[model samples]
Target: MKKREVLLLAFAEHPEQREKCWISLSECNFSCKGCAALSKKERSRLISSKDLAYLVFKSSRYFWGKIIKIAVITGDEITLNPESLLSLISNLKDYSVKYFELSTNSFMIDEDLLKELIKLKLPILVKMDLKAYDEKIYKEYSGKSEVRVDESLNLFEGIDRRAKLIIKNWKIRYLTINPILTSK
Candidate 1:
């Protein structure tokens, strides 16, 4: 059976966003604890930026901006494929599309990419998932406590992306500092 895998963020922002674009994981290799989807049963696929765009354009009606507002993609680590991420952002920006929010684990995000990405001035917001607030807890959750929290903290403080270009630059948005929590 040639099964077609389609993924949608069940906890999406708008009812229309889900119907707008069929999203998928980036086949990410980062072992993250803050990934809610990790403990849940969901479906996703590895799709290209072009494919993602077409999907959005096709489902414009469901999209928040009605093809005018930028889409938001939250996940464990979206910066895995730099080219794909850049392409996706570029394509959307070129078309005057704004991807407002993206939740990520900054395991792979670098400074240069951040600079280039901010150039679009597309009102991009990044929600970085740092496993824990403290070094020990962060390491326990994300596995690399040695520098994950410190590094992530540094990125939040040091990375000088403009205000309009950024909405929130924190490593993790909410109070949930530890990445993953299991109800064992």
Candidate 2:
């Protein structure tokens, strides 16, 4: 499938550190209730992965006088477009980014995409937001079925096992499940 155009919602340096930056992407696969991305009204024009990388690099240099060492790729559902995400990461690496942290809902990740992500050879910390453990609660909160999350979790486990046996020094930390607990 052709890569979708990336709709950049925001780009800014970390509140406490200039060497870190956040790249927020627009749109999502899931319509989770009370999602922060839902409150973001302004969005940049759709751009290609290469252009987005250049813009990020330029913005970093303009604001901090240097390229950011760490990039946090966060959005409503960053994995919605796997090709675009991979392309963006590849382009960012070209600018010599030291590390990447991807915060996602973990609904769109599949085995193929996971393999591609493993091939990146960069240290990536995946922060997966688990909406809820109960199927009914998950569906109610995210407007999506929980089966996808289970699939993703299984994929992460399988990859982790394979990495341990095949690649002794895997850089990707796999999945860090962060459940979003809410009081009803």
- Name the candidate that leads on TM-score: 2
lDDT of 2 by residue, 37-82 (tens): 6324533345667877887788777766888788888866788788
Please write out the lDDT profile of model 1 over residues 1-184, one tens digit for every residue: 1112224532223333332232334334455565556324533554457765655554553434455365566554566666777777676565556555666777666676677677767767776665566877666666664374355446656655544343332221111112222222
lDDT of model 2, residue 116: 94
What TM-score should be assigned to candidate 2? 0.76
Model 1's C-alpha root-mean-square deviation from the true structure amounts to 9.2
Model 1 misplacement above 4 A: 1-6, 9-24, 32-35, 38-42, 62-65, 156-184
Give the Cα error of residue 104 in candidate 2, in Å: 0.9
Clashing residue pairs, backbone N/CA/C < 3 A, model 1: 33-179, 33-180, 34-179, 65-69, 70-98, 128-171, 131-179, 139-145
Report lDDT (Cα) of residue 38, candidate 1.
Answer: 36
